[model samples]
Target chain A: MNAVSRALTDGWVITKRNLIKIKRVPEVLIFVLISPIMFVLLFAFVFGGAINPGDGVSYKEFLIGGIFAQTVVFGATFTGAGLAEDMQKGIIDRFRSLPMSPAAVLVGRTTSDVVYNVLSLIIMALTGLLVGWRIRDGALDALAGFGLLLLFAYAISWVMAWVGLLVPSVEVINNASFIVIMPLTFVSNAFVPIQSFDGVLRTIVEWNPVSALTQAARDLFGNLPPGETVSDAWSLQHPALYTLLWVVGILLVFVPLSVRQYRLASSK
Target chain B: MAVAGNDGDEGVDELTEMISATGLVKRYKNVEALRGLDLSVPEGKVLALLGPNGAGKTTAVRILATLIKPDEGTAVVAGRDVLNDAEGVRRSIGLSGQYAAVDEHLTGFENLEMVGRLYGLGGVASKARARELLERFDLSDAGDRPSKTYSGGMRRRLDLAGALVAAPPVLILDEPTTGLDPRSRQQMWEVIRELVGAGSTLLLTTQYLEEADKLADDIVVIDHGRQIARGTADELKSQTGGERIEVVLVDDGDRDAAVAVLGQVATGEVQSGDSERALTAAVTGGADSLSQVLAGFAAGGIAVLDIGLRRPTLDDVFLSLTGHATESDTDSDAGSAGGEGA
Candidate 1:
């Protein structure tokens, strides 16, 4: 095969290797699957009675989109952590020493991590349904919303992939991703409505990509209450388009950056 | 030592020099892992890089393996420039690093198959190659088990097998038997010997003097990121000098008399091992020195528990050159920084 074709083919092999880790190490999958369920239960029940999205909307319905946003965003950490852990192992040196494409490792890692998001999405959706979350929008639109979430998560995975290579340790990647993600998810419309925030925080939330993703999910799922309009900011006005821009922007910036970093990354 | 031909003979067509590097310098922060080191390995010959902890053996291997680039200088492996044609170099070399680089989660077969695939062997061929290697490494039964479950030696064999997946012309092994048991180490040596016997050029790094003595056609002694000496094993031994007469006394009291007698035949400094109740001195004139030492001891009435004339080992060579024993510091000074992390 040609170089590019070989890279993709090699990437597929690595992706399969990663997926096998998920299978062999079921605890990883269990923990990943449980967090989304726990998020659905915790936010829908613990914070459900206290937080209000608006009139005509149960907190459960409002929380589903936010939960999906948060879960998928959290899922991106797997990519970074996986890369960092692989970095710590001798396996990476083996990979580097091989004649395979350098980009294949990162491409495979980010690709396989999409499975984590998909699995958690399935579990979260089931849990969301049990908790009385409903999708009023048509099935195709809802499918589109899920697709956007996966796409957004995949892009975010590249960002984490870059961080994974930049950092020194796998444990550090976890804490590092937490530092960046915790604020991005919580400060947006993930667990609370944008209206709940005040002044600068509200403006920040209105433009936050997490908020755009959550807002788009809510719009597609028809979870937004009638008459309760989103923020007037252009980002919130076209949440899907804004979210897509962030996805594209993140991929464009991180893909090559991480690949370059991968080339430089040696097994310590 | 077979130094690189300095004639700049571009058309020499010497396939013998499968790997060569000049003035390789790698710095990790303030530590210079490799400083102006040069190396070359003839085709189908084994070159052992012998050194202690922080001696830059691994650093040199990493550069040649194309796992990391040096800060200054250049390397070519299998006729490909390490910097400009790293992929080409990689395609021609099989590298087994200090730690076994096999995946723990994957079965032995799976790990080798993955390596084969990455080396660009197609799916079916990768599997066949993996099975073939499994059989060759004596791991056919354990091939289905995850590498994490294998014994350390088994894991190491699996790792070496992974490196051989593509049967690259050049092979680099960095301390391949560092943690192995004696039997396993011997087994690994046998495997390595077979590879060399098959006419694959090999460059291996090791702290064990015996390992280098047994496996290497030529030895490079590196310390503190620099090449101190390079030669064949016999050449290195002879360069260190002639055999030494070691006299051990039954009691510590006789040590003084034994030391005095040994001094007569001693050609170099008469060194005493205080706790071992022994005095050793480098002696020239071989058998003549031995007879003189024995006759002198008899005249002095020094009780001799043991006495022998021993040839210089690589250990002696290491000590004579580095002013230290040939033992693993368990860490190399230059090993701490600058290599890329995966």
Candidate 2:
């Protein structure tokens, strides 16, 4: 087989290996699905009374887009932690010795994680619907919104893949991604309006790619309250374009970076 | 010791070297794992890398398997250069690491099937090969269960089966039986012997001298990242002066007298055991040396608690060459107990 076909076939094999883990360890899938449901409930009810999205849109509708954005981003952590755990195990040594494509392992890893993000997205959307969140836009726009979230999540998987290869242990990868991701997701409009932040924090929030992603999802889903004043920031005004740019940019940079890291990575 | 010729200038041989490495040097951040080590294993032969922990055996194996590159060396396995054509080298060899590398979440059959697929076997063929290997390794009963439920020995057998999925021409096993129980170790040895008998070139590393003697056609004794001795097991044993006479004294004060009597029959220096009440020496006459030592002790009126004639073990070989026993000597309680029983 040619190089591209070889990588795809080998990667598909590895992808199958990873997906089998989900079947064998249902607890992991339960935890992955449960956390998003909990987040949807927590933010929808606990903060729903106190916080107003400041428009005709109910907090639930505005919140679903943010929840989708945040959940998928957090879902990227699975890639990092999985790769770290694999690195600590002897399985990686077996993979390295194989005549399969070098990029296959990373390709397989990042791809299977997309399945995880998809499952969590479905669960969260169902919980969101129960809590009165709806896709106000037509079906085509809603599909695009979900697609964008998955695309952005796929890019982040590569970033986490690089982090996974860099960290020494699974625990370190979890802690490290948590440190970076918590701030990135929180400072964005995922939970609260970016306008609420003051001074320097506002600038960081406005420019954050995660905020752009949340804005893009809201736009595509038509979840924004009618006549709600959108952020004047160029990124939020063209949120879809901005989010697409970040997706392309992240994949371009991190894909090669992660594949290189995989090449250099050695298990302890 | 006669070094294996690095250049193919030695008289023409009917056998080809399936694995050949010269001047292998690998330096980790703090330790030089391999320093100018050389090795050669002819096709269909078993060459054992006999060494203690951190003796660079794994480093050498990793280099030959194309899992890692050596900083200063050239290696060719099955007619492929390891550095320049790593994929070719990988295609030609099967490697089983010190640890069982099977996926715990996958069934024994699935793990082997995945390996076969990675080796580029078609889906149907991979499944068939997996079943074949599972049956051969006696894992057919557990083929459908996740390998996390497997015993240590079963997991190792599954891991070994994975390596053989492609039936690569050369097999590199790094400390394959290092942590196995005696029974499991015997089973693994038998499996390895079967593979070699079927004409696979085998290079295995182990700390057990008996393991090497039992299975290896030639033994390469390495220490601190360098080859100290390379020869057949018998030649290596003779280098340590053949059989050993171990004596336990009834009185601690008789230690000096015991050494003096043993020194007459010993071809090498007499070594005192950890306790003052025991002494051991390497001798040439085997049982005759034991008889001579008994006569001398009787003539000197020295009391003897126990005495026995035993073959030189890997520990004896290490002590004779490196001035230290194998690193596993103190902590390997089971291994030492088995040695005493032998």
Candidate 3:
């Protein structure tokens, strides 16, 4: 087989290995499913009453899109943690010594983690519906919104994959990704409106890829309040296009970077 | 004498070297893990790389397995250069590291099957190969169970089975039996022996002299990333002299008398043991030397608390060659320590 086909076949095999871990360790799935549900309810009940997104969109409706974006972005860290754990466990040595394509492990890892993001998205959507959130847009648009969230998160998985290979241990990757991801998700429009922020924080939110991700999801889900105008910032005004650009840009940068790192990542 | 006319047949009868490496040098930032190490394994023969922790055994093995590149060296395994044709080397060799590299969450069968598939075996063939290996390694009953539930020995067997998934021509096992209980170690040795009996060229790294003695056709002793000695197990043992006679006196005051008694039968230098009451001496005659020493002790009026004849261990071999006990060296490079089993 050619290199691309070989990578795909090898990657599919590795992806199967990773997916089996989820089946055997249901606790991981439970935690993955539970966190998004908890985020949905906590924001819908606690902040839902106190905060107004304005222009008559209910707080629950406004919150679900942000929650979906946040949950999937957090899900990307699982890719890093899994890779780090594999490095620590010495299983990567086995993979490295194999005749498979060099890109297979990272490809398989990031691909399998998409399953986590998808499952969490499903749980969050169910919780959103129960909490009085509705997809006001057409079915295809809502699907596109979910697709955008996954694509952006998938790109972020490559970034985390690089971090995972560089870090020495799983704990370090968890702590490192947390330090970076927490602010990336929180300082954006995921949990609050960009209108509430002022000055540099506002500009940061306007340009933050997380903000673009949330704004795109909100627009595609039709959760944006009727008659509410998006910010004039090019990123927010064309959030879908902006998020797509970040997705492509991140993949372009991190794919080669991560593959290089994987080649250099010795278990020792 | 009668075979003098058959000289030409001897050339054809010689085994091909399946694995050969020359002047392998690997350097970590501050520590040099391998310093001009050389290794060779003839077809269907086992060559054990023997050393203590941090002796660069793992580094040499890693280089041969194509898991890491040597700073300077030329290595060919199963007819493929490690640097220029790493994929070919990888394809021809199976590597089982010190740590059992099986995925803990995967079933024993799944782990082997996954490896087989990665080896380019199709789905049906991979499944069949996994089942066959599971039976061969005595893991059939546990085939469906997650490998995490396996004992240390079982996990090692599964890892070995994973290595054999492709039936590669050459196998590199680093510390295959380290950390295993004696029974498990013996079981692994038996499994390895079975593989060797089937005529697979094997290069294994180990710290246990007894293990090398039991399994390897030739043994290479290394220390601090350099080759210290290379010979068969018996040749290495003979280099340190013969059987050792260790005697512990009942009274510390008998130490002088004990030394004198031991020295009479000693072929080499008589050495004092850790305690003042004990002494050790290397001797030529295995049983006769013990009887002669007993007679000497009796005549000299030396009372012994404990006495025994023992074979020289890896420690003896290391001490004889390096002028230091194997474990006494504390300057293990970080690279080796990470790769060496505890």
Candidate 4:
């Protein structure tokens, strides 16, 4: 009836439809399970020892924060791919003719991916715990850490979905999302400390949302603190707060912008 | 009396137009698709948009369905401004497309139910709607089967059923029966006729002149995103000026001599078919011209296999209007073949 209710109903229907698709295909859940889980295991074995603790916590625990940021951002790149596929398949055009709010389709799709990424994070986090990583903070703090990661995932995914809407073809999706996502992930302190870099790289990492999220999660993990980390925005002064600020800030800006683009393009 | 194709001017009365668009322009990249197109559809009737490839018939339908917006036009569906009231426009219309829009992963039943749910029907009400559409479309038995396995006609039927799930008052079809077999196309025609009989307004775009002749209450012919002519089927055919005299030649070479001889009396347009073996000319004065036409050919020693007087078809109207055929409106072999995997 109204915008909000219509958007909610449309989003729910799309989410349900996607779920039906997943039920029929079944390969998609693997990304929300095995794919991210495998990446976590890779980081745990390959880069765990390199993540030295600045405040005397174990490197594996320190890696958790970086892993959290890495997993969600990696998960986000698929949003664009899914969108590109839907566009190529003409689903977007079909949606344009529907009576519901056009914006709701994008919101529902991005939210659905956020749900998958959150599930993946849980699996990855549990895998981390099984291998001797522990969060010194209480369960509430761990949840807050996850909440920040999910929010960050949603904001980034929204941008990528817009990219999906703008890209010319589905063939370009993987390369495009990866090209956009990888540099942002690597530039952040996903695998190492920004302090370890002395110049331009350090400056880039410091302002990076990926770095902000990792720093926020590390603070929430009570794992370790970099001398430069703050605890204000997400967990205060830590990049998590900055990341949270950026997450909400990005969602606020990009979600509406993405909806506008999707609606305009889809209208054709 | 249906006057279904009104082409904007809303104060003109709702009963005058089932669908209307003015200055409907859609541009993709540097190319303009529907450039300054104006169209209309009156209530409880059918109007067909006829155009060759890239002429913007599909674009107009897309705009009218509210699936896309015109860059510089205003469209109102079922009496609501398309740009300012898109949702209301969407609520008042149904759309069936050239390609079946049903989800492949879902059963026929599920596709209709999903559309119902998206339209805000509760579960029970939605399922009830789905059942009704499925049965009405003669898809009840296989409604529970996945759509991917359905035949082309079956999938298309499912798609049309899904569009009607909400029972929208206005229906827009974009070359919906393009590749359907005769039976399937006829079935679709019956369904469309039934919709009009029930007082639903309809607008359709088609490459098939015969389909338009058989179905449309009125016809609108467009060329290069502009209206060339609009009239009833018989009205258009009658106004085509001269009766067409077609001569099927024994060889393509005879075409030149045939043209040369018939050139004397061909006071109207002359077009050679693609094979160059069949030469057709519109000659005036009916019986007099027909006689002269035969004498000229006989004197030229051209063997005339067959001769007949025939009313101008929509083909003649299109050829006269656009100087080409409408069936080439899209890329060749695009959704055009297959015995229809039924």
Q: TM-score for all predictions?
A: 0.90, 0.89, 0.92, 0.81
The two-chain DockQ for each candidate, comma-separated, is 0.63, 0.49, 0.69, 0.28
Error of 2 at A158 (Å): 0.7
- Candidates sorted by TM-score, best first: 3, 1, 2, 4
lDDT of 4 by residue, B129-148 (tens): 99998899999999998888
TM-score evaluated only on chain B, model 4: 0.74
Worst 10 residues of 2 chain A by lDDT: A259-268
Give the residue spans of candidate 1 off by over 4 A.
A1-3, B1-15, B241-245, B251-277, B281-315, B324-335, B340-342
Candidate 1 DockQ category? medium
Clashing pairs in 3: none
Ranking by DockQ: 3, 1, 2, 4
TM-score of 2: 0.89
Q: What local lDDT score does residue B27 receive in model 2, on the 0 to 100 scale?
A: 75
lDDT of 4 by residue, A32-51 (tens): 68876676778778877776
What stretches of model 3 exceed 4 Å from their correct place?
Answer: B1-14, B249-303, B338-342
Model 1 C-alpha lDDT per residue in residues B1-342, reported as the tens digit of each score = 223455567445454689889999998876778899999898998999988767788888988988888999989888899999998998999999878888999999999999988987889999999999999999999999888899999999999998899999999999989989999999999999999999999999987777988999999998878999998887887678758887778778877777777787787788976556877898877788899888987887877888898877657877888888766553444345455221
lDDT (0 to 1) per candidate: 0.87, 0.87, 0.89, 0.75
- Measured with C-alpha atoms, the lDDT of residue A175 in candidate 1 is 90
lDDT tens readout by residue for model 2, B1-342: 123454568755457788888999887765577789999888889999998776778778878877777889899899899999999988998989887898999999899999999999989999999999999998999999999999888988888988899999999888888789999999998999899999999999988889999999999999877999999998998878778898999999888888999999988799988688989898888788898999999999999888999887888899998888877533332322211110
| Candidate 1 vs 3: which has more TM-score | 3
Query: Which candidate's TM-score is highest?
Result: 3
* Residue pairs of candidate 2 with colliding backbone atoms: none
